[model samples]
Target: MAGVSRTVACLRFGGDDLDPDEISSVLGREPTYARRKGDVWLTPKGLRRVAKSGIWILNTDDAEPGDLDQQVAALFSGLSEDFSIWRNFARLYGGDIYTGVFLSQSNEGLSISPLTLNSIGVRGLEFGLDIYSNTDDDQKGVSEVADETLD
Candidate 1:
């Protein structure tokens, strides 16, 4: 399907965007929680569905930057390039998904959120963001892509 194929930060997603905590209240949960070993957030039960979080049921309308805002910023900062993409994505998609990464200003880790697409077609991507959230928790040079696991 044609959809957003890019990921970026919402530096330009607007300062007036929705707050993360408010989004959390709407969704009824914290931004991130520890994932128990050998546990999955989503599970299949017959034709029905079950999840530990609403992440799997995320809709483009709910993923908007206004709902998520830069809440991840308190947890994730120092974006080098994706900031531009975030602004563009917000203007185009107006929705997003929290990947559930948590961080304190002194934690030495980066947080990430995904922006879903508005127009899905034969030439578009399923979703896209302008930036890549780096999950290198340690100050070491190790790096892993956040979108990989979020999707």
Candidate 2:
């Protein structure tokens, strides 16, 4: 008889908001390794599977609390080498998720705040913008304005 393997790969981003089974369904395969508690596992073929099927999900809306563009810019500004993988993960999921506000930005720079994903018991993320300027033919003007303070 041969040993059975339930090959699966699971990854938890900061918390258990996402489930491995759910991920398996998305990838249509039995995971060989499970990710949780800030650890990654790989069986003989699990690594290859994960490489082919990138991980990350986005849930954006207008009702999300906080300054959307500012938060995104801040996140980009604060990114370090340590966060390269996660940043890539975010990009793979949809850089649009973070840049939704930029996409919606008008010539006047007026747009609604973009929604962000939040896990239970996790601190709510917020953003503040110091400036939003628009330049046209050597002329610069503030297109949109908001309070610098987050809250």
Candidate 3:
């Protein structure tokens, strides 16, 4: 019989004004299933499921300008710290390829984006995130780029 290996993942919701239960609800799971790990929640099963299905959310109370900034900032922070480690760990542990989703409130409306890594320049790395505005008539998108290199 094939063994079912579970992959663990840590979900970090930045900003000082986020409710744990709300985040859990966005994940379509119970709050009890989410355990407090530092500033984020660690869920083995949920993480595995998320790896299989690329779905994520950016929880916000209101779609205000400041709220949008906070959400975007939180996403950038998470990507900078968590994504690299998560990708490396997933590969090392023989897990499937893991992708990152960023959710946030924007001036246009709710936004969702996929985090992607690319190679730019000589031996340099470029991280690109595409932000899609969730609107029917006024569809809009944005991209944030970060370039770095290893010495």
Candidate 4:
């Protein structure tokens, strides 16, 4: 098996009445992207639309694309570790950790560590995973050389 090629992790909080600034204040960190309900926003494809609800997103860009657990840990590194604070935030804004996994081959697979799961569970954050497969078969073999876990 080729295994996973890369992973990206991000923390998000969203709700109809959510205020990015308010959440930022409590988290003591700035958001990578944030918008209020009904605010004008533009898509990466250049499409323009209005936001349906307020959202605050914090991305782990500083972390290299590799282990999902390590990436998730990087996202939470400096953030509050208090369960009550996270639970309160989730109750009000519905927070979750979203992870995007890019597979190098059709049979690629990965697993999450129990320690990482425990960390997420204690924070009251919902965990989500999205897998993406490479459409081009030509690069499938490249993953063998590029897989960081092998190092």
Candidate 5:
């Protein structure tokens, strides 16, 4: 089995009353997924799901999922470097912006550069990780590693 399979990263912004059109206009980029408040959609399993709030997501995962630093760099690419744009967007929309990273691995780990950390901090965005361990024999051990990494 592979120790580390994939690392996906994305920027997600959500609010109770966010307008997808307005967000697109302000960000000058299209979202991978967007849902307005009250929008209803069917899940992959054919289950009906209704959006409780507005959501805009931009997936910035690199084709090569091995390097998190490269993925983060790609995430900020083509986006404005001016912090005011982000600040104004937060003020106008909602401050519920986050960098979502999903890691699928068995025992391997990765590191994000200080530059990437600084960028996320300057944007006032939360960083969230969902780590999935492939090895079922030691799920608890993997969780302990994840906990330590967070701390």
Candidate 6:
């Protein structure tokens, strides 16, 4: 059998910090699950089955090539759900993606977006950004254009 692999993670904002409905209006795609407790869920399956918790980085391996990769957009879309909503989030907490060390600081820093889903092609769209780890250059696991190259 194929090994278990999934690189999807849920964005964990404070419990009372956001309104799921407002997020829905921003992404133009209704969340698979939206609660007043401030959570918006999405997957290619339309709304998600939340089996895990907190920034789950799941990139499935046994499936066929599909938008499972592009579904990263759905997560990004959640951020753009509303400019005001995201703006408020950035203002209240932090902005952009936080480093692993930053997250380990005195406060529970927020996780924000750094990529823009701008281009579209017949093979679907593409994302151009870098995901790096906090380590020396030799130890760097990811860097430059997180397209399907690593996949």
What's the alpha carbon RMSD for model 3?
16.9
The per-prediction tally of clashing pairs is 23, 8, 0, 0, 0, 12
Tens-digit per-residue lDDT, 37-82, candidate 2: 3334353334522222323322222212224444333333322323
Q: Lowest summed lDDT over 10 consecutive residues: which window, candidate 3?
A: 142-151
How far does residue 62 in candidate 1 sit from its true spot (Å)? 22
Q: Which lDDT values do the candidates have, in the order given?
A: 0.29, 0.28, 0.27, 0.71, 0.60, 0.31
Query: For candidate 2, which ten residues in a row score worst on lDDT?
Result: 142-151
Summarize candidate 4's per-residue lDDT along 1-151 as a digit string, tens digits.
6558777777878888988998888777888778888998775457787887788888765222358788778878877767798888888877887776776667877888999998888888888876667775433211222211112
Off by over 4 Å in 6: 1-4, 38-71, 77-85, 90-151
Candidate 3, position 30, lDDT: 39
Q: Tens digits of per-residue lDDT for model 6 on 74-146? A: 4554234445655554444222321111111222222223443231121132323232232324221111111
The segments of candidate 1 whose C-alpha lies over 4 angstroms from its true place after superposition are 1-17, 33-93, 97-126, 129-151
RMSD of candidates 1 onward, in order: 16.8, 19.4, 16.9, 7.6, 6.9, 14.0
After superposition, which runs of candidate 2 have C-alpha atoms over 4 Å from their true positions? Answer: 1-55, 63-66, 70-82, 87-98, 101-107, 110-151
Best by TM-score: 4
On the 0 to 100 scale, the lDDT of residue 77 in model 3 is 42
Q: Please write out the lDDT profile of model 1 over residues 1-151, one tens digit for every residue.
A: 2222222222111123334444344334343322222334432223422222222122222222222334334222332233444444344434343233222232233323433222121112233333322443432110112222332
Task: For residue 102, give model 1's deviation from the true position in Å.
Answer: 21
Candidate 6 local lDDT, residue 87: 54
Instruction: Compute the lDDT of residue 110 as modeled in candidate 3.
Output: 30
lDDT of 5 at 2: 33
Q: Over the stretch 10-77, how does candidate 5's per-residue lDDT look in tens digits?
A: 66667777888887787678887778878897754577878777777766643234555666677667
